[model samples]
Structures are given as C-alpha cells and as structure tokens.
Target: MRTVQYELMRPGELLAEKERFSVAYLPVGPLEWHGPHMPFGTDPLDAQAVARGVAQKIGGVVFPTLYCGTERARTPQELQCMGFEEEDLYVVGMDVPANPVKSCYFPEEAFGMILREYLLQIVEQGFRLVVIVNGHGASGQLATGERLAREFTHNTPATVLFTRAMQKLEEGDQRLGHANISETAMQMYISGDSVDLSQLPPREVPLKTCDWGIADALEFQGLGNAAHTVEQDPRDATAQLGRRYVENGVQRISDQVLAAYAELEPRQGTKA
Candidate 1:
C-alpha cells in the first residue's frame, strides 16, 4: 500500500522522497449545463472528489481540475428564458469565463497541447506517472486521451494514465456521462446546498423534444458542444448516494493506479 499519499510534497518533501512513489492525478471537467438542479461544475467536481479519495487511498498527487473543452453553446430557448441576449456567465471550477459565451472551448489538438505541456512540466519535476481523470465522458475525448497518453509516454519515462484505464484493472462498473445517477449523486455529496434540486428541469419529456430532435436541428456551427450544459433528474439525487458513488469510483481508480504502479515499478527499478 505505498503509504496512500498525494501532492503534499513541498520542495523539501520532494527532496525527501526522491525514491518515493510519485504520481500526479489531474481531473478534467467542462463548464456546462447539468440540468437545473446540479451546478455547472458537477462533472469535474465529481471526478475530483473521486480522485482525491483515491489519492488518499493509493498515495498519489491530486492536481487542479481543468474546465476547458472544445466548444460550448447555450440553447436559444435557455438564453431567452434566462434573459440573456448573450450567453450567461458561469464558473465551472476556479475559473470564471470572460463572458457567458463559451470561452473555455477550443480545438481538441489545442486542449491536448495544454495537457501535454502541463504533464511535461510535472515530469521534469521528477514525477514518474501522471494520471488524468476526464469527467467530460465524451468518447472523442477518451479516444484522443488515449492517443495523448501514448504520445506522452513514448516521449518520456513518465507514463500517462486516464480514468478509463482503471476499468481494465477492476471489475466494477463506472460510467462516463453527465446528469446520470452517478454524477447527480456525486454532486449531492460534494455540494449539497449549491445543488438546487427544486429547480430541476422536467424529465420524461419526449427525447425528440425540439431541443434536440427532428425539425430545426441546431448544429452549433463549427464549435463542438463541449461546454453545453444539460442535466438529468438531479433533484432525485441524495447526498448519501453521492458519497457512495464517490467512494466506489475512487476505489476503482485506486485499484487501477496501484496496478499501473506495480507494472511500471520494475522498469523504474522500484518495488511497491
């Protein structure tokens, strides 16, 4: 059990643990709709909570959460009702958008470059493994993440591990989506008061509702829907459930992270 640690290593601490197990865990989330009940940062926050618990359990460093994504747009109707001639502003994690208009959105390549730069710096600081947890749950992000992980590891001794890689080490079920039970519950646990369950948007509506269906299907032009927000029946979520989800998810990640560390240990001439 590698002493279950995280990024508390200061300058002196770093020197103290030159041979200590080192890993950096980052959480990736986007600012977007999460129904009316949950806050916009639900996805990333949920992932962060899970990552922190895992770091505590497996001796890993938890880095700050990244909220940027490809592109984000508010539906015309939501904008109208919110009384916004433009996109209303919201904060996902620590960053407040310049305008309500999705500013964090960018090309996948650009996002990858940002991630690569961040990891490269960490590797230079002597970290042996970098674990990134993407709560965005987009298949494109996951696919791209895999490629980035490979490229990152190919270029350096530092290894990149994404949340999905954990599934291979554990039999447990973990989903990658928003507003689902897992996400809603996790939000409830993370910030119960901030979650306005009373204002939850209506569910049980036809899937073909004008918002996403036949008729004037609105393609967000060239921008992707990375920051676009939507929610499930988050009002139905409970803090108890949120805690359970976080606990379970963290365990899954910790299990996989430990396995990865073990597999890479021999190459580094270290033992766990």
Candidate 2:
C-alpha cells in the first residue's frame, strides 16, 4: 500500500513523492498536560492525524510529529485573568502549575532556531509548498510561525504556510481550546483507547487546569481561566466528532496545498 507518512517511506518513494507533489506537512506541538482523560501529546497527535488526512486528499509527506513548542511566561495581567496572584508556576502553555509532570517547552529563541532548521531541511528536500500544522496555541509560537512564514516565503522559492488545526474548518465551530471537547474529540477519532472519559471527574464536576485535561475549560477573566469550570462534557466527545474535525481540516488544507502546488508546478524541475 502507498503511504504519505515521511518516516515510513523509502528514499525512492520520497523522491518520487517530491516529484509528484511539492508539499510537506509538519505536524507541530508540545508535550504538555491535556487533562486526565486525554493523552499528553494531544496537540501533535491531533495535528499528525489531520495532516495525514490532508496529505491523502492532495499529495504530500507527513513529517514525523514535532513534539516541541515554545510559550511565553504569563504576564501579571495574564496571570490575573487566570485567577493567579503570582507567576510561581503559572507559566504559559498548557502545563498548568497544578500538574506535577512538566511539559517539554523550549525557549522562544531556541525553538525558533530549531524550527528554522527543520523548515530549511524540508525546503532543501525540494518541497516548495510546506505546511506547518500548528497544534500548540501559544502566543509566542504563533508569532514565530508568522515571522518565519514571511521570511522563508519571501527569501526562498518555497511558500510556507503556518495554519492552526481546526480553525474555521467547520461552519459554527467554536475556538478549539487547550484539551477542550474539540481536542478530545479529535484524539478520540484517532484512537479510541487514547482517551478515557471515565478517567475524568463526574460530568457535573468542573475540571480545573491541573486536572490534566481541560476538556471544558471556559474563559472567565482572561483566557483559559484557572478558576473556570468545564463548560462541556468530555463524555459527549465521540470518534465521529473527531472524524468530522479531521475530515474538515483535511479538506480545507487540501484546497490550499493543491492550489499552491498547481501554481508552482510550472516551475522548472528536472524530474518528472
């Protein structure tokens, strides 16, 4: 069977794929707490599934999932929004101060260097249209992607696109928060055993940021209120819902990648 997964493909297969389609998908996220019910690698897991779904629709290689991302520390105002008095452990990214296991978070500058290395490597591999499947929703992460997208697209022959997963894919979809129903549903869609709603608190119980998975965290003062209760039920999450998100994400990304590929296909290429 054919595969779009980069790590699984042989060199010959990879080269053939590059000639056929000049697109590469990089599913990026960090290993952070997502709550009790969901896996810790929820972000990248969701990203990989969606990226592969899109690749199959169009044509591309799904790079190995990047489980490292950057986040800025919470400012006084941001901390205040989260109902925190100090920044002792209220740093940004989903690794709440409550969780015992810390996440793999890189400094912004360090992450930028690492990301640039990957981007350059992918481009040098002959992929003219590279899609950065952003799984983590950190402010610093977004800024880095935006900045690099412009730099690489303008300076190089490639066009880099940094897009968040499940953003505006569905007609009335709410913002996909950290380990929220959407993320949980997407994870459920990928693997049933990957999520266990039973592991979570009772439906009526409000899950705090430290519970591990913030399946239903709602903003009260700032964003992702630490004092907020879960607004949705993780039990309501189903593989079917996950499938819808993945399918919708695939379609939206497929459209963009296909368009870019078409425009760049006319460029001079020695192979096929």
Write the residue-wise lDDT of candidate 1 on 96-130 in tens digits: 23223322455667877877777777777777888
| Candidate 2 per-residue C-alpha lDDT over 100-144 given as tens digits, one digit per residue, 9 for 90 to 100 | 677788999998998899999998887888999988777899999
What are the clashing pairs of model 2?
34-212, 34-213, 35-212, 35-213, 36-213
- lDDT for model 2 comes to 0.76
Please list the residue runs of candidate 1 whose C-alpha ends up more than 4 Å from where it truly belongs after superposition: 1-9, 71-103, 164-176, 201-232, 269-272
Tally clashing residue pairs in candidate 1.
11
The prediction achieving the highest lDDT against the true structure is 2
For every model shown, the clashing-pair count is 11, 5
Candidate 2 worst ten-residue window by lDDT: 212-221
* Per-prediction TM-score to the true structure, in the order listed: 0.69, 0.88
Off by over 4 Å in 2: 85-89, 169-171, 210-227, 265-272
Best by TM-score: 2
